[model samples]
Target chain A: MKKTLFEKIWERHIVDTLPDGTTQLYIDRLYCHEVTSPQAFAGLRERGLKPFRPGRITCVPDHNVPTLNQDKPIEDPVSRKQVDTLEKNATDFGLAYYGLQHPRNGIVHVVGPENGLTLPGMTIVCGDSHTSTHGALGAIAFGIGTSEVEMTLATQCIMQRKPRTMRITLDGQLRAGVTAKDIALYIIARMTTGGATGYFVEYAGEAIRQATMEERLTICNLSIEMGARGGMIAPDAVTFEYLKGRAFAPRGAEWEKARVAWQNLYSDEGAVFDKEVHFCAEDIDPMVTYGTNPGMGIGIREAIPSLDSIDEAGRISFLKALDYMGFRPGEPMLGKPVDYVFLGSCTNGRIEDFRAFASIVKGRRKASGLTAWLVPGSRQVEQQIRAEGIDAILTEAGFALRQPGCSACLAMNDDKVPAGRYAVSTSNRNFEGRQGPGARTILAGPLVAAAAAVTGKITDPRTL
Target chain B: MRNTFTILTSTCVPLPLENVDTDQIIPARFLKATTREGFGDNLFRDWRYDESGHPRPGFVLNQPTYKGDILVAGKNFGSGSSREHAAWAITGYGFRAVVSSFFADIFKNNSMNNGLLPVVVSPEFLSELFASIEADAGTQLTIDLPAQTLTNQATGRSEHFDINAYKKDCLVNGLDDIDYLLANKEKIERYESLVTSYKLQVTSK
Candidate 1:
């Protein structure tokens, strides 16, 4: 049978089928962070189970660690305990742990690829929704709940009912100033939040193939927002080039063998998918989310949809979302003043994202009215910013790059947007209180975030 | 551990808002705790209470008229985040099941794993369910796990929902996946050996 890339990878990882018809899928890599892993670790302890494949697991403390003052102890008692618990669990299980202040310490998703522990033709699972970010390397990666996390820890396999496959083809040259973040927001808006539920999406066509690895990672990072089991792109020359010299990537002759093997990772010419959708790159604009969910987005220059545009069934929720966001239906988002500008998360905290932000803020000073949180995804990315002198440009623009962590994206630390404030965030989610209680988030790409930083309000990046 | 589910009957709390993400179910700041207990106190924490820690009577849970073990919500309930804490909060708050027209994939799985049933009804049926509850807060819902049926007692309307056969079995028996995988450890080891040998051949060549 002619198979799609997802099917081929799924087939390779099957250990056995449970009588319940679920596949016992072998996991090649398991990434853990402080927030979700504590319960899984506790479960293992309760069952008196040891890690089946300790070598396959990697742990880091990102979600709870403060972006600033990482050298000091975490001040919040509960947050401190969670991070301490993860370190204890990692030590107990004999797993590789990148603790706070470690050179490789960063967001689980960001550090995984940066160190090359993420490879093509593997099955990766993390206790994070953004684990789909790793699927850009052509792996069958997805988020799992804590129970599944514990299952993988005890057995190195997860029980999964194989999801149907969907192929989303975005074909055409992207407009100038448009980005992978815009492409993601564009797709989610067209196909609402639940559009891809129960399907593993494989991104294909011109736009995806031409996207850099970092861009591809950004695209895959938001797969969960569209309700996908996961999303992946076939490994190609671009993927190989990205992985060539990374720390955990294969070296020398092993690299040659791996490259040859990975070359066969794409779908067969006549492969079939459960569903197919095509999008034109020209249709997308530098996007911004106006309402609470990721799907409630519009092109930057467009107005919020009128109530008549929302179906009767969704109107109540639509109005409720608008009320929560302090937005009026049919109003333009172009000049809405914002109070904070956050430029980091697994979704957009990469070095390329920093570069994109710096490109727009090169000569412009930040708007004095709004506060800005410019955080990198990883220490490596932070180093790249300094090495490339992007830091100088940002400092000149009156912005300071903070330490790396999942800062303000979910606001687990002190980097929270104050109550009732409007924030133009480069994070994946804009849910109510996601940044902080009573905090309003307008999701956008790094470029859009940069524009908002300089103007202190929602502005079209293309115009800036 | 959650008790096994066979049949659950209870009044329903209606939240008509769409895309009720897990973040709203349990906010990120509340997730700093390492343990899963006491999450119910903070369930829908922001929505149920003000920043001053006072209950907002306008919210459904706080209203004297509405109280229930079943949560009926709008379409696409539990949309964002893979945090199982959302499921923990729902179950911890004593909700045996959540009814919606649609559900996000990870949230559904998390709910099932934690024994919180996610009942999906047709859009019209869900609308009617909401209308029935709005007309009176005393509307009752009965969910039969074995038969995979959800009945709105007030309207006498029942709908067949879908649940994975294996998952249904697990829920009925309160069985966990880890125990089953442990019993099949030999199978996993054999598969790993095969994969390792295949990789060895590629590297050597």
Candidate 2:
């Protein structure tokens, strides 16, 4: 039988079928972080059990660590405790840990791929929704709850009912100014936040094939936003080239052998998906979200949809979202004053993302009243920013690069937008108060965020 | 872990707003806690409270007219982030079940594993639930887990839902993922050995 790319990787990871009809899936790699893993580690201690394969696990403290002043101890007692617990747990379990100030420390999703821990035809598990970010390398990765985290730690496996498969194909060439983030936002708008529930999605077609690995990572990072179990792309030459010299990647003869195996990781030509959708890359715009949910998005030049255009069942929530955003029906989102602009997160905190942001902000002065944060996804990305002179351009434009952490993408850190402020963010989510109490997040791509940073409001990059 | 989840019949608190994501359920700032306890206090903390930290009179849970063990929320409940704190909050707040027209996949799984029943009903039925509860503060719904049915006692309406057969068994037995896997340890070890030998053979080739 012809197999889809998801199926090919999934079947390889199956250990056995449980009597209850769930598959016992073997996990190749497990990534842990400060926020979610403490409880799982506690669970392990309570049971008097140790990790089945300690070397297969890697721990990092990202969610609770401060983006600034990493040399000092965390001042927030609660955040301090979480980070301390992870450090102790990692040491106790004999797992590799990259805590704050470690040379390789970064967001779990970013560091995994940067260090070449993520690989093709592997099954990765992390206690994070953005673990799908690793699927860019053709790995079958997804988030797990604390209990499932404990399951993976104890047995190196998880019990899961296989999900149906869906394929989203993006064909044709992207227009200038459009980005992987824009394509992702466009798809989420068309699919709604719950569109692809109960399935694993495989991204294919010309545009995806053409996307850089970082771009592919951005696309896969948002898979959970649309309610998919996960998303993946087949490994190709681009993938191999990216992984070739990474710290943890295979070398020499092992690399050659791995390449041979990864070359066969694509879906067979005749394989059929349970559901399939196609979009022209030209149809996507430099996208932005206007409402509370990521799904409520439109092109930069477009107006928010009128309430009359929405169904009765959805109209009430639609109105509520607009009320929360302080946006009127049928109003153009362009030129709306933005108080803050954020450029970091697993979604768009990569080196390419920084380059894109720097490209737009090159010679322009930042808007007088705007506060923009430029955070890198990893230390490697931060180093690249400095090495490539993007940091100088940013500093010249009045935006300083903050330390690497999941800052402003979430409110766990000190870098939070104040109440009732509108922030143009490149983060994946724009949910109510996700950045802070009463802060309204407007989700956009790197270019759009850069435009907002310099213009002090939502502006069409095309107009800029 | 608490076991044996057979049936639950209780009143419900309704949150009519749609897309009530996990972040809203429990804000990211509150996620700094290492343990799962005390999250119930912050369940819907921002929505339930004003900036000054006083309970908002307008929020559903704050209203004295409604009180219940079940939380009937709007569609796509528990979307965003796999914090598991959302499930922790619902269960921590003593909600035996959460009913919605749809649930984000990870949230649903987390709820099921954490001793909280996630009941998925038809959109029309979900609407009926909101209306029925609103009309009468005394509204009670019964969720029969083994039977896979959710019934509205006020309206005498009932709907059958689907659950994985294995999950159904676990729920009834009060078994979590860890419990089940531990019970089947030998099976796991055997499978691991098989996988090890298989990998070795492939690498040798």
Candidate 3:
């Protein structure tokens, strides 16, 4: 039988299968961050175990580190302690450590690909849901819990029951203002957040192939939002080009050999998928989430669904979400005032995203009523923003660029939006208080966020 | 010792909201700990307490009339973030199992890894389970791990749930993946030697 890209990577990494039906999947790369690794390291210490392959592991402190003041100690005592724990753990384990203020220090997912640590035809695991972002290079990457983290550290292999496969083919070209983020939100809205559970998705067709590597990463990063095990697009010229000449990527003859292996990473011509779904990219619109979950989204010009549109079983929760957002069921979301704007996360924190945001706010001044936090994904992205003069344009538009970290995405640092205030965010997830305790977040693409920062409300980017 | 899960009979606390994500289970601010203890006190922290740090009497967890070892929630529970902290919070708050019509993939794995059972029932069955709890807080549900069945004592309705055979065995035996992997170290090494290496090792830029 022919095999899919996921199966190709998965089968190659299988070490063994137990009588109880669990396969031991070997992981080529394991990324760790401060928030989740401390406990795992503590477990290793208690068990008197060491990392089986320390060279394959990489660590960074991003979740709790502040986006400002790289030179000063973290003011939040608890946050500082966790960052300290990770540094100590990495040092004791002899792993590559990227502590706060290191040039490579950033969100674990962002730095992996940008630094060329993520590669095609490999199995990657991280203690973060956005680890799926690495699958854009045709790798099998997914999130695992800390117990699995300890397992990987002790053995470099994790037990798993394989998931079913899905193929989501996005055909044709996207509309003028519709972006990769919009397409992601569109798919999640259609899938209703749980539709893809128990499946590993493979994104294919013209639209997916046409997307830039950064755009592809954004698409795969949201695979978890719809409950997928992970998502991937087979490596092509775009993937190879994105990895070429990067700091950690292979050079010369080794690069040529690696490219040849990556070229065969696609699904065979007659490959079979357990399920398949199709969509036209032109059907997607600039989307904005109106309620608590990522699935509660609509086209920018649309109104929030009325009570009658919701099924009786879900109406209570639906109404509760609207109430938390301070939105009525029938209210139009377009002109709803936005008090804050956040422009960074693993999902939309790439250089392309910064370019898109700058495209909209180049000449226009930011709304005086809104407080905007424009952060880069990594120090490299920050340096690029300056080299490309994007920072000057943002400053000229009255927006300041903050240092790199996973700031405001989960509000672990001081970049939180105050309670009950509305924020137009380019980051993923709008769960209640995700941006801050009781802070209302409207999830959107970079262009939509830029539009909101200028108008101080949820404005359609196309209209602006 | 508490890792072994076999049989449980307990009443349930009903959270009739869909997409109850991990962030709501435990907010990001409280994840600064270096260890796993004391998370239960802050489970559902924002919802259980007000800005003034007082209990919200209206929340299901804070109500005196409802007390249980099970959490019966609406569909699509634990939908965001791969934080096992969410599972830690649930287990810490005294829930051995979470029942819903659906669950996110990573959360389900995390729950089972921590010996917290995730029971998936039909949509109608979950709704009825919530209704039974709302009608009377003392209603009990029995989960038989070996049989893979969940029974509602109030209505005497039963449903079969699915779990990975290996995970179920590990949970029943109070075993974990690390133990199994540690035992099979030689197999892992042999397999690694036979495979063609695709890894690009770089110590620094």
Best by DockQ: 3
Q: Write the per-residue lDDT of candidate 3 for residues B139-164, one digit (tens) a residue.
A: 99999999999999999999999887
Pairs with steric clashes in candidate 2: B3-B174, B4-B174
Query: What 10-residue stretch in candidate 1 chain B is worst by lDDT?
Result: B196-205
For TM-score, the strongest prediction is 3
Model 1 lDDT tens row, B1-205:
4579999998999998888999989999988878888788899999899999999989998997888889999988998889999999998889989999999888988998898999999999999999999898899989998999999998899999998787888899998788678989999989987875213111100
Pairs in clash, predicted candidate 1 = none
Ranking by DockQ: 3, 1, 2
* Ranking of all predicted structures according to lDDT, beginning with the best and ending with the worst: 3, 1, 2
Question: Candidate 2, B41: how far from true, in Å?
Answer: 0.4
Candidate 3, A182-279: lDDT as tens digits: 99999999988788888999999999999999999999999988989999999999999999998777889889999998899999998999999999
Candidate 3, residue B125: lDDT: 92
Q: Every model's DockQ, to 2 decimals? A: 0.53, 0.48, 0.74
- Cα deviation at A49, candidate 3, in Å, is 0.6
Runs in model 2 deviating more than 4 A are B196-205
Model 1 global lDDT (CA atoms, 0 to 1):
0.91
lDDT of each: 0.91, 0.90, 0.91
